[model samples]
Target: MNPGDRASWNQTANADFVLVGLFGETKPATFLYMVTFIFFLLALAGNTLLIVLIRVQPRLRTPMDFFISQLSLMYLMYISMTVPKMLVGQVTGDRAISASCCGVQMFFSLNLNGEKCFLLAAMASNPYTAICRHLHYTLLMSQRVCECLLSGCWLLGMSDGFLLTPIIMSVPFSQSRKIPSFFCETPALLKLSCADISLYRTFMYVCCVLMLLIPIVVILSSYASILRLIHRMNSAEGQRKAFATCSFQLILGLFFFGAAVYTYMLPTSYHTAEKDIMIPAFYTIITPVLNPLIYNFRNKDFTGALRSTMQLGLSPRKAGNGRA
Candidate 1:
């Protein structure tokens, strides 16, 4: 596949490749489809409610919550793009997609992935400022700053997807264009190319490392510093409070990074298409569903805010009687 000369490009027969279910058996695939569908619903509902609560309540309008609300929205968008195709593919048994369809999938997967990485980095930085530099957190993470950071994240993510577009276009898709994976991943797309894919492989490897690995490193480093700073607090009560703030992020970050690296960083030989679907479900479905509940329910302020929201809606109207 690595010969760079254009003379080597040869057309192949259009053979339909049957896409198999993810786990090892057909029975389990049906079970997993139901389970994943339920997870998709929970993830959507939880994240949507999180956004509504954030927007409807004025007291939740801090810099951190603002970014968190954006995070929830982005997660919802990301999952929505991937999960439905997966369900349809599994249920209807229509595995193959047109070249344009595959291209769209690739674009969204990369775009959402890069943006989510950038968002997590911002999320980690949010607490770092609040914990390490409380006095200057206001100056450091203002509304303007938050907007600029988020804008930069979206731009950087789009840049990564745009870079992939030209390379993906040049690849000659043989008559047999079926991708084995549930969704279109770049590597799986690369395998279908009749053209030499060495350059594309090289490009993807570099981008993945930069967009994925570097962010993971930055997040881990930021959290390490946070933990250290938290440990150094003078009072036990202050330390406990700081630990509570940092713990949710650490757990969610670990789950996101762990599943991602496991899915993408492994050798090509290890990548049977069956493995791809399961790992993505964790970050996409499980993370979003868990994020709002874990973050809000654990926090005292947000719990009180939620309680207030409930009470506000339930207050009884005054009776017409003057002195009952």
Candidate 2:
């Protein structure tokens, strides 16, 4: 590498970053952090419960439930990545994060966020298959097919992290090391660069568009097919059931993708410090807490499994007999 590039790398490699988190040191900020912590706990409990219920219940061993469980797992990992550090920073009054730690955080965040985009699209296929192709549903969404789709999501998502993190982190950062957002989001980190990043920004923009566009097209088309099939159904009951099956996923995809588009796809001219902080908080903090609740309350199969698990847990006699 050239001496100029080596110096820039050295500066970035040794730099320590301070995160300017979501709130200030005012009483209101303290209250907000408390609320954030509460949401984090709820997300932790809810996703964990959903995963356990899916695992232990034979009734929930279908392709739909499998996708939901994976979604829950992703939510679990996503929130765990950012919220704890934010909370810790809040409590200790230390928002300093090392450059290495920041890159690592950005890596996983990109990885999981990308994975979720495709995963949601893959999940939309379940309802489309079930509603629009009932005869071929079993064949199309078999366990093998589901596994392959999931593996593809993981691989594609990880590729984003692996390809982009190093390039972004290697660029020279401004001497001012404070990141405006609560987490090491790519956009926020880009603002810290001292170099002219116009070319890289355009490249990143194209990458983000492709990452978002492919899954979005898949999801929209899947839903459109499902809607057409539902419209043609003779029974209102069948239509309601089909809509119910898809409602949670549709809601989730909207919440997730809407925030993601705002964060990554929008022009830099539209972004302010507050919008950057608030928007990421919405998807990273708020959505994870809501996902499990939406799935659990709206999903009869999931609720039934949860109820059964609770009953089994509470019954000493049944538990003992099963163990014996």
Candidate 3:
């Protein structure tokens, strides 16, 4: 095979890879299966409820809520990428995944992760518009604008997936086919490759910086501006409200983006295969639960919205869409 033929390398080189470990859907632990099933149910319930509330509750409609709904949708898709696989493996104990399927899985997981980063940045922009330019916010963030932002998020996510998956899959995995974790991810899949991946590792770092760091900077800047409004306000109620919104945005960024940057941006020297499994598991499986909790708890308005919508019971009345 010619060293320069990337296509041929990708087509023929991945046969050695066979997924194992973390349950293959044949005969998994019963207790583990139940627990994973419960988590899957929670993720589905929480994200689906959030989306429904955003849609059915007329009062919950706004640019921020729009973004939150998008986030919930992303959470649903994101969790589906891995949790179902885990659930299936638990029920059947069949952990076998082909190399092509592994590439596809990593592509989607990474794609949704990128979509999330962009969505969070868009979420940050909402409060900044509300606080920094209160009057013009409605104009600035009209439906068309929000639609554009969302479309851009998906486009960028697809680009991230398209750019990285093939390259990573092309790496020569000459020996073990068994991946260390439940799902195929960039770091773990790269680990299976026999060839030196220094160049790709560097590329991963750059992508991490772009995907993880840049959004964080955007979030911080938005919060910084919002915090100014909080401090300047003499009314305790107004200050608290401003602070609450800022805190949620900051927490969301820190929890999700921070974890990603630490996992992906840091040098390969710092990572262990065992440790890598834990982070992805937390963010992928655990964070979906946390996303709803964060919005519900840290932002009191969401709790109030939920209560209001529950009371209305899908009446679809043009009332009680009251501001939180």
Best TM-score among the predictions, by candidate number: 2
Query: How close to the true structure is residue 232 of candidate 1, measured as C-alpha lDDT?
Result: 79
Against the unseen true structure, what C-alpha lDDT does each candidate score?
A: 0.75, 0.88, 0.78
Residues 164-228, candidate 2, lDDT per residue (tens digit)?
Answer: 89988876788788998898989988998877998778877888887898999999999988888
Error of 1 at 118 (Å): 0.8
lDDT of 1 by residue, 227-308 (tens): 8987777999988878887888888888887877766666677765556656766777789888887776566667777788
TM-score of 1: 0.85
- Return the top candidate by lDDT: 2
Ranking of all candidate structures by their TM-score, best first: 2, 3, 1
Model 2 scores a TM of 0.94
Candidate 3 local lDDT, 105-200, one digit each (tens): 899988999999988998899888988999999899999999999999888877778889988887777455677777888887877766788999
Candidates by lDDT, descending order: 2, 3, 1
Which consecutive 10 residues in model 1 have the weakest lDDT in total?
A: 11-20
Task: Tell me the spans in candidate 2 whose CA falls farther than 4 Å from its real position.
Answer: 1-12, 317-324
Poorest 10 consecutive residues of model 3 by lDDT?
16-25
Off by over 4 Å in 3: 1-33, 297-324
